[model samples]
Target: MMRVKPSAFVMLAYLIFLLLPIYWLLMMSLKTNTEITSTFTLWPADLTFRNYQTILTDPSWYMGYVNSLIYVGLNTLISITVALPAAYAFSRYRFMGDKHLFFWLLTNRMAPPAVFALPFFQFYSAFGLIDTHIAVALAHCLFNVPLAVWILEGFMRGVPKEIDETAYIDGYSWPRFFVKIFMPLIASGIGVAAFFCFMFSWVELLLARTLTTTDAKPIAAIMTRTVSASGMDWGVLAAAGILTIIPGALVIYFVRNYIAKGFALGRV
Candidate 1:
């Protein structure tokens, strides 16, 4: 028999430590309440699909996921759109207090979501925009825009200034150059920025829960419904947790290469 390396054992232990919770959640999702509460098996003794069935068939459960996707998508689009020009300006130009302005923008991202939650609620309430997808999307932009700008600026700065001059000399209009020539050069950066924006908006519960009532309630808020007169719906909650991980997993899968490039600071 071959001897196992200590490092391999450590790596295996680390993986188990990381994956144990997820595995437990999956097991719980497959078990009924009785099996879950009474038994402590590594795998489900009596597997059931009722929990997943309930979530898929119920509008309230399904709609929470829809609402989350809507706001997260909207927030990602708005953040990337607003950050592009702002990042370009910061990367290529200098003006009065430009550094200060950039720092101030990042300060907005540093601030806790709770600090702005009440103010956001009041502002949206005044405009009658509460409980809408746009409201949550806009609220998330407060943080996402700054983060997107900071990230995109780093990648933009990695690009040479000669490209802009060359494009301008070729009689390329500003919009034409930015969209056609410049954007593609920093495509990986954009992917990284969009990924962060989507993740922040997707996982952020405070602003999403605080801003919406029923109409635009996100899955994060709806997950609280597991507790009731009948006690906690552990099976359904676990199933929902599994479903929640899928979208983010899919996103990371598609952008894995771009994300790798981003880690290398946009190098070829």
Candidate 2:
């Protein structure tokens, strides 16, 4: 008989620990609220997909997901577009207060979203941007841009300045060189940055909740509908949660390679 290694046991246990909650949520989603609240079973006695059906059929429920995706995509696009040039400058040039400015940008990322909640609410209200997808996307930029810059700058610094010189020597204009030559070199970094931006904008509830009302409410916000005067809808809530996990999970799967490269080469 072969002996199992101690590290194998440890890894198995760690994976189980990480997977337990997701397993429980899946089981709960398949169960009725009565079964959930009254039973102690590890698995559902009668599996049903009514919870998922409801969310899929309900316009209000499904639209929340649509709203979330819209803002998240917008935020990722804006953050990457803004960060690329800023990061390139940081990696390629040195100006007075450059270091100070870089640190200051990071300070913005470090600050809690709650700290800017009221200010953002007030600012957008003045501009009549409340309950709009663009409002939430722009608000998330306050955090995501700095983070994108930080990560992109790390990857940019790893690139040789000789590349830029060679491109210029080949008669490539600044825009052409950046778009055609420079960006491909840092594609992994962009993927990493966009992944982080998407994740942050997707999962963040506080600012997202505060900044939007019905017109642009996120899936996370819509998840709150599980609570009612009758009590919580555990089954529906669990199903919604599982569905919400799908997008982020898919994104990670697609960008897994780039993210691994980011860990090795960039700030990630």
Tell me, by TM-score, which candidate is best: 2
**Against the correct fold, how does model 1 do in TM-score?**
0.95
Note each model's CA RMSD in angstroms. 1.9, 1.4
Residue pairs clashing, model 2: none
**Residue 201 displacement in candidate 2 (angstroms):** 0.8
Misplaced by over 4 Å in model 2 are: 263-268
TM-score of each: 0.95, 0.96
Q: Write candidate 2's Cα lDDT for 182-210 as tens digits.
A: 99998889899999999999999899999
Question: Model 2: which ten-residue window has the lowest total lDDT?
Answer: 259-268
lDDT of 1 by residue, 1-268 (tens): 9999999999999999999999999999999999989878899888899999999999999999999999999999999999999999999999899999999999999999989989999999999999999999999999999989988998999999999999999999999999999999988899999998998899999999989999999987898999999999999999999999999999999889778765553444
